[model samples]
Target: MDIPVRAHIERLLDAHASDGLSEAVEQAFRAVPRHLFIPPVALACRDDGPQIIDRDADPDAWWDAVYSRASIVTQLDDGATDIRAGSGDYTCSSSAPSTVADLLQRLELAPGHRVLEIGTGTGWTAALLSHLVGAANVTSVEVDPVLGAQAASNLAASGHAPYLVVGDGALGCPERAPYDRVHVTCGIRRVPYAWIEQSRPGAVIVLPYCPGFGTDHALRLVVTPDGMAYGRFPGFASYMTMRAQRPQRDQPARTDADKHHLTTRVDPRTIGHAPAGADLAIAALTGLDSLGQADQDEDGPRYRLWVSDPAVPRSWAVAVWRPGQDEYQIYQVGDRPVWEEVVAAYFRWVGWGEPGRDRFGMTVHADGQEVWLDTPDQVIGSEARSAC
Candidate 1:
């Protein structure tokens, strides 16, 4: 006998009932057998941490993983690498059940509303949408052909026949125009205007808004008759980026022979101590990426905050704070003093009363998107050209 998957679903629903999981979503969870969509071997289960489950190697572990409240990495390196090998960039996944439930509740789906799903990794979400609406009303698009085919097989096995499209999800499926709701599973640095254009005037568009920073939050936008979609971010979520908008890894340039050095009394740790939405604000204000590392120096253990400009190669800066030091040392290279910009952004966030993610909103227009703190008229930053 195996562990009863429905039992696990009940437990999951109970755990998240107060966290916005709805009765309709609970019914869908009980209806879908997640194990059917997952491959038999080498499942990546993120319980306390990441654990690999090989069915042949350990059947019990595989079953537990299949039912666990964790996101399973279905494909890595865009399906180029074998799962048995055990290590690569996660390209696609079946999202954690709790995450799926929350997003579904936020969507506010009706009985016959048409939904357009971006990033049909395992078709689990599509199946759930089909359960809410009808299969004929769901259009799921996957960028990878292999994943698309696999998802199609999984959906068919589960007795669902949603319209599955194999193409660039960024472009969306226009033939099935004017979706009632647009739900994107993939994280994107920039929200594509095409998603808004394909939605009905009152349609809701939900997606993970990742500005290539510390964390991502779900952005819920409502399309308007004026050809714009605008709304606030409810909470945090981190998803893999759409392939087309994925950022290339740019290593810091070699030490500049003429590097500039300075010192600040504003302890480097202060910059690391971020308020609610400070990281997102900093990323938007300076257009830079940041990381913090703890290491030992000649004197003692030190904390270093690194800031780099991903778009401009060779631009980087580091601020180091050591024990008993009143001031932090800063070293900067390239044309931009990234550390200074980060510090300035931190002050700006502080000056704004340290607002949370809920206070932040996004507006997607025909030309581009704008991020605002409290209102659209007070735009913090705008990206004229989206990578997508």
Candidate 2:
């Protein structure tokens, strides 16, 4: 690990080595050179470590960005617009090293395993997978023609030749069916039948599933012998939605109610119940398929979340961030009164814990995102339908 490339991956591998995924991740990291994957962009290495990048700043900031924890939005709307101008609705990216590590941990890939990666952004993940199980054992798909070609070059430069395809990922590549594992780099509102169909019996499929709401939760499922996959939320993570699957949500409705008030605009009838704290609010909203954040705003940190859903709106619960700063209030309203749903869902999630996101399983049918939780084999709407 002497060269810039070696050092970049060495640091990444070190972070996860203690976590049992060290070997698979190390092989993958050692196999691919991240600098080669990020084309034309000036290479910047940070002394603090972890090759995360912030592509928004000048040359001086690029080094810090690449090593930081935040994801550098690679393609906005699948390379449709300028991210610098704030319209690059994220499509693909070189995800932060830790996130990639977490996803790989969820994947649980073993030696000699075959894996299919949905997005080849920077070809980093695919290269890592290829390294873990040999390049011949990996197949990667990218929707954008340009990105696909670039990834091919990136993979080639990294000394691995993963079969890269320029096509839709939602329709997983059939030629490479019966894969031992399937992992998606992009966020998906709908889980594709292709994944379940192509996965070999007992194969594990890990992906971020956005059930047509404001927040997308990571789903790590295993293909059962019967062609069905059941798993639970590994954790909360978000990605730029796949190009064809971006939510077509209307702007959130604005209520005349005061931002710092108890009165909600939605009918009280909709309020089955609410909880006593922000944690419960966050959990319930997330249980409603909405992800919520509950934290004390200490030190006045600025946090921004990107969203496009009317149902799973976004808001802030502001509080003092200093010593003896205990007063807290909800400032929810505007186009998206996100916190409203948080309070609304807290009551529901407080109860859903009876079973849990894990207890809720997926039974793929020919036409539905069929899922039921301790309940029966109830059919559910596709991610798109749920948004509507």
Candidate 3:
């Protein structure tokens, strides 16, 4: 049953080989049985998004989902929610085949090289790494104990055995230090210095950088001899945040109701429509999390932007814009001028030629991480320089 589906996936991946997919990764996909790693009733990958696939309820749909180029959500709300009940928050998933292939290709793995993988959600990636670098050279760490044990079982069933550690993935597995490559399967707001410290100089570290404003991007950093990791974001990616670094979803406290109102000629949509790099720039500059929503008003369409510090609840800002309006209304509270900083970031991004994620890179030093555009000398904002 798995043979034909595996072949079809391999063919699809091979078609994309010219676009960065490598033959080695294609072979790894062909050899591994992804279904073995997922739950009996799990959400299968689909073009539109994830759809539930219950082997007992619908076998054919389940098979198709296992073979589809989509990510299978294995756990919801960190395993607290009942997926069988219909809806839940996505916590862990078997990443889409194409995404996994892309990350592996970017890794540029070689035989006999030691690799450390963080966030072994379902163990499919670990199996692929084992196939590429031999099981003895692969070490995978998972933050969830249940997921770790399940991954171990799945790997054993697939006849591949890799070192599996059940602990926080943010702190890379030091038991196996000096790894040649480190691949993280989760999104992180801040890249842990421990990952750089654990890797050998020149080792490559790939992870999804999600600063919580726009979409996440796959950041590829190479460990430097001077105990720093620096690299550029190649493309956009979406992954679950590490357990420890997950954003607090709580709404900001409504303590300060004395909101200062002001008017700005800058349209909110301009910043909203800006490239993902602009969001990264805003996050770096303001050091604040932003959320945007759209709705219909009596006048027509309306958009609202919320910028606040999740850690420090005192400072928050809101900007409201309506279509055909030249001056947008802004309400700011606390010491920080959140909306003003966002405007500054937008102009700064445009001043630097409005570069894409590829043109932007990050340097993670002992002092702090600094986001740079085109070159490391040009830091994103004055705040980053002072923080570093």
Candidate 4:
């Protein structure tokens, strides 16, 4: 409509032209006005800090932000706190234009194709999908009823009415069975078997797989003849975790005298900020998730690599790195040998030729999923905890 946010978005879509962003997909992007989907009062996430924009207070700023590359924060604390009040886990939002463009391109939608969408946040993506394929062919599911109703109104005002269901998206909309394509907006820890069961063979499912480890990835999976779906990581993605699969809050650290103490030459940053492939490898092998936190000490900068099991919250390990130190201290507080297993996994990833995210593949079936290297049979790990 309004001239499109042509430069940056076009360049991003064009770069992925070979594998994604077909002409129809680009037109669909131009067709959906992002501002219509965004709330009047929302937060625009920035690297420095989140700036709150209110349409009534400053319509100019709100319009600019909706068109900008920043993702708009629509809800905070799952709607527990007012967005203007500030400070809460980002529960929901309209994804950045770049992310929406990348994922829609990967969907490869065709006119008249049946599509099932999960997490109908703001309904912008469903509208886009409806534009690509007829609106009657699209079905969207949202977990939150309030957001679902709001999204319904937004879609109606925009002259698109895709089927909207209020239910847990992980379960999927089974009534609209045998979908031609599946598009997911939320980050998933487990690939729900229901999704595969509902889709026909050869369905293309695109989702953000956030394992709570290092960097999350965008996966493009194709359902197979035998009812299994296999795919590879196309690139990195960082979306909020699916509400159903969100991890428990970490318990306070134990200060027991029997704690294991060790020192290693490996910098904590090496493991903390490892490439996406290594993150997948280590999480799969050790059954542990990791995150790095930065701190300032008297000597300048320090890093802490936190490794913990999502299933067993009590078991954890922390590797601390200080400036100018060849040796870093590692503290293990549980029986999992969390540090040792992580070190082994780290070296194992290195031994496998230091594969990047592109070389990793995932297989999802009814029971669970597995992450493999290069091919399906060469499964590096069989845990479904990080597969979705």
Best by TM-score: 4
**Candidate 1 structure quality by residue, lDDT tens digits, 1-388:** 1457767666666766677767788778777777778887754657466677877888878877777677888787888898766688888888887777777878999889999999899999999999998899999999999999999999999998999999999889999988999988998888778888899999998888888655678888999999999999898777888998876686555665738888888887777767548877887788787778788877779898878877875787788988888888898887787887888888898899988878888888989888898899988888886444
- The lDDT ranking, best first, is 4, 1, 3, 2
Model 4 TM-score, all chains together:
0.92
Query: Which run of 10 residues does model 2 get worst, by summed lDDT?
Result: 267-276
- After superposing all C-alphas onto the true structure, candidate 4 shows an RMSD in angstroms of 3.0
Model 3 agreement with the true structure over 113-215: per-residue lDDT tens digits: 8999999889999999999999999999998998888999999999999999999887788989989999899988888888999999999999988887756
lDDT value for model 3:
0.83
Distance (Å) between predicted and true CA of 95, model 4? 0.6
Clashes of 2: 14
**Model 4: per-residue Cα lDDT over 277-348, one tens digit each:** 999898778768888999897778889998888888878889999877889999877677888888889999
Candidate 3 global TM-score: 0.90
List candidate 4 segments past 4 Å from native: 1-21, 250-258, 384-388
**Deviation in Å, model 2, residue 209 alpha carbon:** 2.0
Clashes of each: 0, 14, 0, 0
Which lDDT tens digits does candidate 2 get at residues 10-30?
665565556566565756666
Candidate 3 lDDT trough over 10 residues, lowest sum: 379-388
- Model 1 alpha-carbon drift over 4 Å, by segment: 1-3, 43-48, 250-262, 293-304, 321-324, 386-388
TM-scores of the candidates in the order shown: 0.91, 0.70, 0.90, 0.92
**Alpha-carbon shift of residue 272 in model 3 (angstroms):** 1.7
Candidates in order: C-alpha RMSD to true structure: 2.6, 6.8, 2.9, 3.0
